[model samples]
Target: MIERDEAAIYVDGLTKTFGSGKNAVTAVEDVSFAVAPGEVIGLLGPNGAGKTTLLKSILGLVLPDEGEVRIQGSDVYDRPQQAYEHVDAMLEGARNDYWRLTVQENLRYFAAIHGQNPAVVADRHKSLLERLDLDKKADTAVRDLSRGMKQKVSLASVLAGDVSVVFLDEPTLGLDVESSLKLQQELVRLTEERGLTLVLSSHNMDVIEEICDRVVIMSGGHIVANDTVEALIADFERQGYRITVRDIDDVVLADLRERFRMTSIEQTNRKTRFEIAADSATFYRLTDVMEHHEIDIDSIETVQPDLAEAFVELTKSSESSMKPNTIEKGDGD
Candidate 1:
């Protein structure tokens, strides 16, 4: 874990609530996390899990009721200007860019707002355009570009200045597979070349698994899990398996269902197929049960767990165990 003083972004015991009394909804509660310089952090949660609220609070868009945020060791509340001087965000994906401005003009406009002279960062802008495959459309108005192109333009505009920290929400919402792959590559390159710190939120688990150095999962306005993608998956002890067997009767099926978690059961003539999630010992117990019943095991295949599976299991477990809070319906996420 990065120390608060050395972190590129630090959020300490932050909490935010909406409305009052019984109608109040707690968006974030005592959440604390730090991002190291040049590290790519993935923020994941179901809708209404307070991901947007947390991001807004960090960016000073929504004032928190308690706690504090800092950027590069500068307090955001006490030194707003200094703290945010090196920060940029591409929230709302393509909508973050101005429709009236040409692509290059948008970059210049964003850079100028960040206290950067466009001429001084001209090479940087050019490199961004070339790397994102937007060089040809640099002179075209954003409104006239395709959706994928527009999304890339939004990202480029965010990195137009000499900023070191960035927040991106659904950065690849409307892109083709090739375009998404290209954008991912460029983002990794920029992080390596410029030491950029990124906080990205997306429903695309594949993207997160491929790019993120660490993942922070939130459920019910609380941080439930934080770790590397590989670690998270490895820590999930329940292994999934697809098994096919023969001569299994209803009594055996009922016994299996009662004894283990099973799903996707299909039966055809003398053969039966089912999927199950269990630990290694439990799996051995299952095999023993089958042997006792004289069931013939036709096939067994291990299903490897990935980030999506880990996210589902973690969030589901968290949601199930969470006590109900006074959260109003239709409040900000």
Candidate 2:
């Protein structure tokens, strides 16, 4: 576990509820987590799962009914100015950039507001523009640029200042495939090269799986799972496997479906392919049943569970009991 003092961002027992009486709704409930310095943590949840509330609470946009939030050991509420001195955010895929100003000017303005001398960080700003493929648009007014270009400008603006911690909500919301990939790569590089602590929220699981050191999944106003991406996927019990076989009939298919959780059954040119989710014991039993049915197994391979699958399973499980379970990263490293 990371010590509270050492964490770049820390939240403890944070709870927030909207309204009052029976009409009231609890958005976040007793949520606690920490992000280590230079770590990229992904925050994921479905709509109305309290993700926005949690982020807003952490950013001090929304006051919580309970718990404390600290940034680099400075109490957020007690020392708001000090705690947020080296922090910035690109919320909802946009930053508050001056539309009338040129792209470079907006970056300079953001840097200046953050107590950074634009001239001093001019090289950094230039690199940001170049890396995001916005160098050509540097002199163009933000209002004249397209939506995708604006999104890139927003990200560059967030990194323009001398900040250590950044919170990005839907960073890739309006980006093209190439732009999104570029942004993801740059984010990873910036985190490694500059030790920038990032808390990214995106529905794109691929982005989360690719870059995040750990993921915090929220459901029903609670942290349902907090663990490294690999750990979360591995911890999921039902492993998926794709099997291709020949000499299989409807009776065999029906039996397989009855015995195990089956899906994606496809048949082509006398060959049958299907997928199943099962444990080791159940898998072996499935093989036995296939053998008894005289099925010729052409091939079989494990369908590795990715972050998206794990997210679904975790959120679904939390529906039954909204208990928080914090899974620490494994010691394998």
Candidate 3:
């Protein structure tokens, strides 16, 4: 593989399982991938698909049964503290804050630990609070803030350390539309302006599609697919085109039937409507047939599946293929 200067995280052959006997649940299996700097990679999967487990293992909160994980060229398991020196994470519940401390106090506390002096920390805190629109609430106790406000506080902790890479698990969970949009906008700004590499795990496909440059879909203890959102859409061409035509003669109708596999065909008094999944080549063939028959197209529309629908189809397909068949035990014979 060609080496890149911007790789922030590299994980290989990582595997983890819980339990010793028949109850053992394999969370991750031989997962390997790398994340580049300023790239927001979405770790997408349904619940119980090891996204959280994978994040915890990388953060050293849980030990992997096998495989290697590195952050910025340093092995997390071997270097431990040093590997995490330039890394920070914000998972569910935003547990990094002190409920008793005011927002400013919490920011100051984290900044001091990150080796910043009080004055410098305060300055940075002020700037971040202003940017995040939390300046007005800086003196409010963390315990009194709403879920969305605390999410901002959690993000503040990640920013306080000025880490190169940050991990956020379900960052927008339970947030209103306005708050979610703000968080996504801020994340994009951080990536574009500050070169922050982020690994975000969320069930929200829209969030992933909007904010992430690339996505890795995991299912049943494995990575089923990994690529850019555009590439994935183009690869499958899941969205079909719906075409309606003026009354077709016998020859034109026969031509269409022979040339393409029509997914749906409906005949009306004045027109014929059909939906089909065809690639560029197939579409060209379709056009040739239409031209030869001199058929008049009444209307045509391209339908694109939403990310949530795409994710469901992709992940569920993988899970179905991975399911093992049960074998019944024979009784006394």
lDDT of 2 at 253: 88
The CA lDDT of each predicted structure is 0.89, 0.87, 0.79
TM-score per prediction, in order, is 0.88, 0.86, 0.78
lDDT tens digits, residues 1-333, model 3? Answer: 213234688878888877757756677788888888678899987766777778888889989999888888778878878788878888874476898999988888887776777686677679888877789999999999998888888888778866788999888876888878888888888788889889988877778888899998887767888888887776676557889999798677876887786767899997999977777788777878888888899998996755665577678788787643111111000
Tens-digit per-residue lDDT, 19-46, candidate 1: 8786678888899999998899999988
Would you list the rank order by lDDT, best first? 1, 2, 3
Off by over 4 Å in 3: 1-6, 241-301, 324-333
| Candidate 2 residue pairs in clash (backbone atoms < 3 Å) | none
Model 3 quality (TM-score): 0.78
The numbered model that scores best in lDDT is 1
Instruction: Provide the lDDT at 296 for model 3.
Output: 92
